[model samples]
Target: MSDLNARVVIIGAGHAGGTLAALLRQYGHTGPITMVGDEPIAPYQRPPLSKAWLKGEADADSLALKPLEFYAGANIDFRPSVKAVKLERSARRVHLSDGSELGYDFLVIATGARAIALPIPGADLQGVLSLRTAADAEALKAQVGPGKKLAVVGGGYIGLEVAASGRALGAEVVVLEREARLLARVACETLSTFFRDVHEQHGVTFELGASVTGFEGANGHITGVSLADGRIVPCDAAVVGVGVIPNDELAVDSGLETARGVVVDLEARTADPHVFAIGDVAHRPMPIYGRMFRMESVPNALEQAKQAACAITGRPAPAGEVPWQWSDQYDLKLQIAGYAFDVDEIVVRGDPKSGKFAVFHLKGDQLQSVEAINAPPEFMMGRQLIGNRKALDKAKLADPTVSMKEVTA
Candidate 1:
């Protein structure tokens, strides 16, 4: 029995699993590390699928998170196109779709997430698509060009980015959101308003407060979108950017505690001692927020995977700083530094009319988070402010009268 090559099996080769594999090597982990994923291609970024990649500015190679040679050089048994069908927790093994079973000393479930399907009539039509993978982006790109009519379902960051990309290609774009306001799920009103103006300035039409109930298609290609209010919109194609659900079926079947996703502690360890979970699949708590939630961001995935790998490989738990998410919409770069939901007040710093502003969401005198649009200094300063539990005077932060560095000084 050679304990020297102790097996470590990691499911899903997304940002979380990929980072865990690389971090294990960095920590001098000399063991058999196997990375498995259902996707045929190597781990690439989902962020660009809605933005630059769709506009033909970024190539597939540019979107690759890590090169193929890097995985080989690090001695990782990378297994793509292999889906983990079942988890045998008691046996310390995972059953694959190909009738093969692999054992692990430490199992990491980074199965990530999948796009939530639109329950509309023509949701499965050929022209109807969901933006989640590289294949989705490539297909959508081919349909976008000059004089095309495109309808984007959902007004979240993903939908907005796609709208911006399609408009850039000289396509007439329309966004359909069920909510009264855009980005209602994640962002505050102040940030959403800023984005609304950005999209409008680019000639992107807003069909806000509208929900898609069905689609008008003849031969599996979407011709128009049918709204819940019986309004029919003529469009060439449709892109669904609703939301995502965590892939937690295997973890839940294995008797691991799961609320929204796999429940993990600060160290990314699940209820089971030998098994751990990370990425968008893990519903971990934030010491700042005092609650547990699944974060569907690349940053969250990498940070949690790094922490989980450290804990499983006998290294100390590297405490995460702050949970952050970023979005690239046209010329503006939206960066959220911390979680700020149900805030008592919203303070705007700088001129949003100029397309450069930051929203400081506050609960009384305490700062909750900063949603910055083209305001890097505020995002950077607000990040430190969130971590240190420091508060800035609302007036000073609002006025472009002072530099952000002065607050730290």
Candidate 2:
């Protein structure tokens, strides 16, 4: 079949799927493209849903990836509120929930992920929620207001952001993290301490090493949370930000390689030549890290979408950049570049107490990662250093007086 006449079907209309659809057209592919999503709304930004949008600083229209007319104008078949139930790999067809089958020459699975819910009893009670979608954010926003007591059950970026937002809305906020420190899984201890102090100064309480056995509720609504040690934390609402599980059931059911996410090559191709995956759903090999890196960030989604589009169009994948992520809490902006795992030393620049600093994670003078707190120069330079595989002098990097360019040079 000619490339122009080929049919491409994409499942999931989040950042990855939506961006791929647009890029396939932009890359001069005249094929018929269709995108299916379970949500009624079009593809929208998820990052702001937890921060600005939840705080009433941004509106729904601002969250859209593209204007509604863009899809129709581009001749892309966009199906909203539709779910792809099963994948018929052999026949190259997708069975939809609406009793329909869509035939495709190429299929892209970008199912993203779902928030992990607490398995304990009373988790299903009213006032307990997890944020993942637009509906979820709206529900959370309504529950957070003046005088409301909210307990955030996790100390990850999402949980801390929710805590900051709750404080901004005049809600009494308490963050309950089971780990010894905030962001223990993803961040260095230095950065974690900085964020904990910031949250505490904003009137948000933190309970480290606290485990919730279950929730205490009345009549269907949760009134409080019961800790493992028999202590009950009284709250009107709770937001569970434990983590996320990749939505890769379709891939697994179709007999595709699966781990925490769908296994894909560096080019985002699945085990089957015709099948591809991207975004939070694909576990692709990272040459820099020498392992499969499953990144759950917007930058990763955008990069993978472009690579998948190029691969589908018979183009070579571009050189990959260092993975990066960002978060907004209160007036502070945190930008992270590179992975900090297995670092031997951590160097801090500037002052955490002054609310401006950067943490450099190093393995024998080689830059492993950077956590920049309201420091754009550090983030930009740090990303370049990691991408170029450049090592720096620890003393120069830790000195605030030395410019980022000088340190990197």
Candidate 3:
């Protein structure tokens, strides 16, 4: 492809899109590159939006992907607040909401995912909030007033983060979930129990095994949540973070195959040769885990972008480490390093009672992954172990007395 003739257009100014822009420039692809963002601000760290950022402990300045000058200097166009409506793939163009079309030789759909909305009545009330964007953080933060009652409508990471933040702000916080346990979507009962205790210690309350069927409002502002079990969880403000739906509408409408997320090959390329998908919208295959998943973490977004950039630039790329994810709640740092779905055995190292341990998951004798709480060293080594297919003795792995370094060796 001729340098000037080949223009790359990426939808979504997020970690995957922004990092792709930088990678393309670093690899000497001197063609025109433009990043379209639906949000007014450029790409920022999303993990913080649920944790320290919500408590006002962190500022927006530290969440940037690249400085304003960095984008301009690299010859990449940054178009903020642009809504991409339609994909004219046959024309190799994208139709924007502003009645303008942009052409591209190669296109990347990194639109990420949107918060799953509350489906019941009174969902659109004024006091109800969802935390997914910068505007949402600012709005939710403003609502977290002193001595106010905060109701978290989901027990997921986002909901817990908001509950923690609300509790820190001296507001009475309660987490309501339809499931019997918290974080059940991704974690086991043991992990969920650990979190329950941690949150309760921070003055957060949880309504487990309960479902909110509807919201109660007064004058178009939410005031309470109606449970399926015939109870009302009353509050001044409600934060809904049930889950996310992948923003694969563009890919789907553009005739690209999408399942769970945009189904892509190991190279992050969609079935369409001219188009690719990454970040939260990509359901890429993992060779190690032998499964397809869409990971929503900073490392995943960056790694996926790097793989996509390599494929476009004619470089060989490995999937790298097995897919891992993490979340921050209060002072506890939960790091997951592998898939636990098929693991036949789980070994607990360190001490769960001590609130610092690593749950070693293995399929027979082969080490699969490790979920650690406040065990950064074990998490780091586990990442390398899963990537390298490191094996360990089952007996030693479960014994906290044996150093993990020695057991792996």
Candidate 4:
């Protein structure tokens, strides 16, 4: 098939799928492009759902990835509120829930993920929710405001972000974390402690090492959460932000290789060559780390979108991006670069008490990762350093007086 004329069918219409469509066109692909999305509306930004959108700082239109008219103007067939039910690999066709079928030379799966529902009693209650989409944000927003109490389950970034937003909205907020410390799964203890203190300063309470037995409800609405220790934390509503499960069922049913997520090569091409998977649904290779991970972040999605688009359009592969992510809580902006693994030494640049510092995780002289709190320069420099894979002076790195340029030299 001619590269430019090959038909592309993208499933999931999310950050990765949406961007692939745009990148395909940008790279001069003139093939028929059709995008299938399960959401009722066009693809939109999800990062703000738990923060700005919940706090009324962002609107639906503002959150949209593109103006609604951009799809038709670009001559892209955008299908909304449609689910892809079955994949017929032999026929190279996709069966949709709407009783329609799409034939394609190439298929991209970007089904993303859904919030994992807390499998506990009262989880199905009206006021118990999880934020993964604009719809979820809207529902949670209505329930949080003055005179309301919001109980946030989990101590990860999402839960803490919601807690910050709830506090901003004048709701009494309490966080329940099964772990003794917050962000135990994703961050170092130093960073976790810093965030916990920040949230506490914002009038949010914490129930650490607290195992939730279930939730308490009255009239089919959550009224409180019951802890394993016979403690009942009263609240009018609750949000479970444990994590998410990737939507890889369609790929699995289609006989695709999947390990937690759809397995793919560095180019995001599945074993079936004709199919590709990106975003949260892709169990892709992290060449820099020499490992495979299913990264759930915009940067990872955008990188894979470019990878797929370039591979399809016969363009040179784009440079690998340094793994990164960010979080905004109140006035604090936390930027994390690279992964924290097998670290030998940690250098703290500046004081955490000042609320503006960077924690550098190093193995010998090589940088592994850096977590910067309200420190943009440190984040950028650290990201570049990690990508460069160069050794640096530890003493100089920890000295705030030394310029980052000099530290690298």
Tens-place lDDT digits, model 1, residues 242-303: 89899999998888999979999988888787788999999998888677888889889988
Model 4 misplaced stretches (Cα beyond 4 Å): none
Deviation (Å) of 133 in candidate 2 = 0.6
Error of 3 at 302 (Å): 0.6
> In candidate 3, how many Å is residue 35 off?
0.5
User: Comparing 1 and 4 by lDDT, which wins?
Assistant: 4
Q: lDDT per residue, candidate 4, 312-354, as tens digits? A: 8989889999989999999999999999877888899999999
C-alpha RMSD between model 1 and the true structure: 2.1
Q: What is the number of residue pairs that collide in model 4?
A: 0
**Model 1 residue 143 lDDT score:** 91
Extract clashing residue pairs from model 2.
Answer: none
lDDT to native, each model: 0.86, 0.91, 0.84, 0.93
Model 2 agreement with the true structure over 377-399: per-residue lDDT tens digits = 99999989888877698889989
RMSD of each: 2.1, 1.3, 1.7, 1.0
TM-score of 3: 0.96
Task: Compare candidates 1 and 2 on lDDT and give the better one.
Answer: 2
**lDDT: which candidate is best?**
4
Clashes of each: 0, 0, 0, 0
Please, what are the lDDT tens digits per residue for candidate 3 over residues 60-146? 678888877788988889999997899988899999987888999889999999999978998898878999887888888888868
